[model samples]
Target: MRNKPPSLTESQYFLLAALLDGPLHGYGIIKATEQATDGRLRLAVGTLYGALDRLERARLVEADHEEIVDGRARRYYRLTNDGAAALQIEARRLQQAANVVIGRTRTAEA
Candidate 1:
């Protein structure tokens, strides 16, 4: 059976994070993710597109429009309301978990 789908994958988190500022084309999303992660998460073209497809189907993202970039067609995407909500929830969860670790480390040092 297929697993539950509420949980966001790392790729999804990064993608959604990139869109939090505004819409972006595939390459823009790739660059944003790389820059945000300080070059730690370079996504291959196929992987980025595949993740975009999944996010689109999940209603977490939507294609804004298509445009030509140096004779190649590029599609822009933006996060939906659901996507923003999911991203916010995931970020809060991560922040809370991080606080626990930080508190433990500080206590041990004290």
Candidate 2:
């Protein structure tokens, strides 16, 4: 198998998860993350954009399109294939870690 990307931070993971369904603009991602986390992951505009910049550099996400809305420019982003794989790998890793803490074994799966 190919090498997997490094694990994502909670913030990065949340941002990636927000893009699982097609593409979303920066505001949409911020709102979606907060809603998904029950208002726990509220992101300021600066934080959101900063994470976006890093994720873009890591090739985990890319701008899919842009729009001019009410005299403002909005850029929408989509998760790249590599990003999806990283998220899946991280999810499985976390699940295994959780199972260990819960004293659940592999055979628990039915």
Candidate 3:
């Protein structure tokens, strides 16, 4: 049996983070993810599209509209209210986790 996917993967987190700033097309999302991760992550077209499809299904992300860019049709994506709220919660969770790690490291040094 195939393992069920997590509610949110790191890629999804990055993609949602990108939408936090504004809506973006596929290529734009790829670029934004790269920039956000400081080039640590590069999303392939297939991977990016797959993530978008799943997010749309979850009602977390919606296609705003198609825009013409360089003679190509680009579908822009925006975060829905649910998506924004989810991201906020995930961010807070991560922040709390980071604080714990920091506290551990500081104690180790002391």
Off by over 4 Å in 1: 1-5
**TM-score for model 1?**
0.92
lDDT of 1 by residue, 1-110 (tens): 13233678888899999999999999899999999999999989999999999988888899999999899998999999888888888898889999999999999999
Against the reference, the lDDT scores of all candidates come to 0.90, 0.90, 0.86
lDDT tens readout by residue for model 3, 1-110: 02332368889999988998888898889899999999998999999999999988887899998978789898899998888877877888889999999999999999
Cα-based lDDT at residue 14, candidate 3: 92
TM-score to true structure, per model: 0.92, 0.88, 0.89
Sorting all predicted structures by lDDT, with the top scorer first, yields: 1, 2, 3
User: How are the candidates ranked when ordered by TM-score, highest leading?
Assistant: 1, 3, 2
After superposition, the stretches of candidate 2 with alpha carbons farther than 4 Å from their true spots are: 104-110
Score candidate 2 by TM-score against the native.
0.88
Identify the candidate with maximal TM-score.
1
lDDT, candidate 1, residue 3? Answer: 28
Measured by C-alpha RMSD in angstroms, how accurate is candidate 3? 4.4
